[model samples]
Target: MTHPEAHKSHRAGWLRAAVLGANDGIVSTASLIIGIATASATQEYILLAGIAGLVAGAMSMAAGEYVSVSSQADTENADLAIEKKALENDFESELDELTEIYQTRGLESGLAKQVAQQLMAHDALGAHAKDELGITDTTSAKPLQAAFYSAVTFTIGAALPLSLAWAIPGHLLVISVAVSSLFFLALLGGIAAKIGGASITAGALRVTVWGALAMSITAVVGNFFGVATQ
Candidate 1:
């Protein structure tokens, strides 16, 4: 099987993460708006809730993505630092370690040793970083970049449903929001799954199931509250 190396992997991986975060943000926030709208709440109250959900969800997603990506970046940096020191102070041992690693992969002992020696002689740190440490040529982390894209894409996706609900009237508003939001989520899942070389049906099914659950539970709660107060 083709290892599907990093340069291509990076784009698809980032696309998947962005789609996941944005789709969740959109679907959950839209479902909240739908649930509240179904509660027979006045337009103003529903709109206020939608606005609040949008702002809170977007900011929360941004902060969470930032923290998660930062953690990954920190770990990679730590690995790089440790590796740099090993290469500097214990070069021979490090070289032996790399040679053995190549042998384990598939190379014969003599060939592994020769390959390791050449790699080290050419670029010791890079070779070890990829083979030994699992860091690679094209998959480095960029926390700020990830955070920005997630937040922006999420806000855009969420606005679709919120805007629809606000502009429409009565129970029809809720229907429009729910149907459109589900369609968007399913489309996102299929596109992202295709990009990642995964199953479209699996992707669509997973997102649709979660969206259904969220909307159903929220709608039930809203209906109960509506009945209790009336």
Candidate 2:
């Protein structure tokens, strides 16, 4: 019997975008609602603010993720281009570079050179790209994919608190949204950590703490502003 290993590193690109989007959506919208509700705003006004935050946050996440990932993609492309030219101009030097990389990774010199020769014979540019530049297909940047994930996850995350705000009433709205959003944040963190092969408890605690702090600070600010206005 042969065993195949499964790795989670391939999930890096989309997972990062999704986690960030969902986390931002929950924290920002929840904080916004909690702040407004704490200030004694009308339910309608609070819900309206939540909706606006959700829409704005989703768009911002999409655009920001797209642009940021696009930049990384551009950088990777530029590096690949330079590597390609270097290979075209100095095949021997590039071959030696790849061999040296494998040697440093613990292969004997002769074995390293042979391995490099075989890899380069099959695909010189690919060998150099993977070994020297650290660019692999699994880890390559995808702007559109990142943007889509971020936008969708953010909308879903923001809806949680917004719906809670709508369903709950009075001063209780603030407390309810705060508590529920923290739970959502913790759940999200744990899920992300689990998928990424990290400690779920640590992840959950990390996000929960930050979310609680965010809501608390927003509540204080809202209370202050509400008092000052009155």
Candidate 3:
């Protein structure tokens, strides 16, 4: 008996949402804390802002992912419904369409027709959904799953910087939170990339660069405002 090969494609749906959520959580919360601190806000105010950012960001990410993925799922279901109706109305035509699809993918016409016939007989809608509409169990949209992952991961990620801010006080709070947040971001990127079978270094660098930029810009704005107010 041959062992089945492991694949990462199945992780595509949740992984996208998780990585996006975590990255946003860390970057946004940390940036908010850093900006507040740079503006000479008290430690209490900085921590408060971090908490608010965490809660708001997590909810925003969850809502955004849910709505977007739900739209995709709706479109997919609509397509499948249309395909089902066509299959019901003209089974022979649908069979011929599948056969032509297989033929275009390199199978000989006769073999393609035979394969299509067998597949349609086994599970007509499934065969059409996969081959014709390009929707598979692994690749299909999942709004609830996406929303849950995003919300949970974002909360976890945002908690890191918030905890650091709470623990570290005084002038060092800004530097400590900034540095630690970058490390967290890099670690998250590497883990996500490794799991998805991509380049770890590239992924880590990609998130780190953007995180740093966001923090920098926010800091500048905060400092400008602080100076203007004074």
TM-score of each: 0.92, 0.98, 0.98
Instruction: Compute the lDDT of residue 23 as modeled in candidate 1.
Output: 91
Candidate 1 lands at a TM-score of 0.92
Worst 10 residues of 1 by lDDT: 4-13
Of 1 and 3, the candidate ranking higher by lDDT: 3
Taking the tens digit of each residue's C-alpha lDDT, what string does model 2 give over 24-60?
9999999999888878789999999999999999999
For candidate 2, the 10 contiguous residues with the lowest summed lDDT are 170-179
Once fitted onto the true fold, the runs of candidate 3 whose alpha carbons sit more than 4 angstroms away are none
| Clash tally for model 1 | 0
Error at 42, model 1, angstroms:
1.2
Pairs that collide in candidate 2 are none
lDDT of 3 by residue, 1-230 (tens): 99998789999999999999999999999999989888989999998899999999999999999999999999999999999999999999999999999999999999999999999999999999999999999999999999999999999999999999999989898889889999999999999999999999999999999999999999899888878877
lDDT of 3 at 134: 96
lDDT of 3 at 34: 89
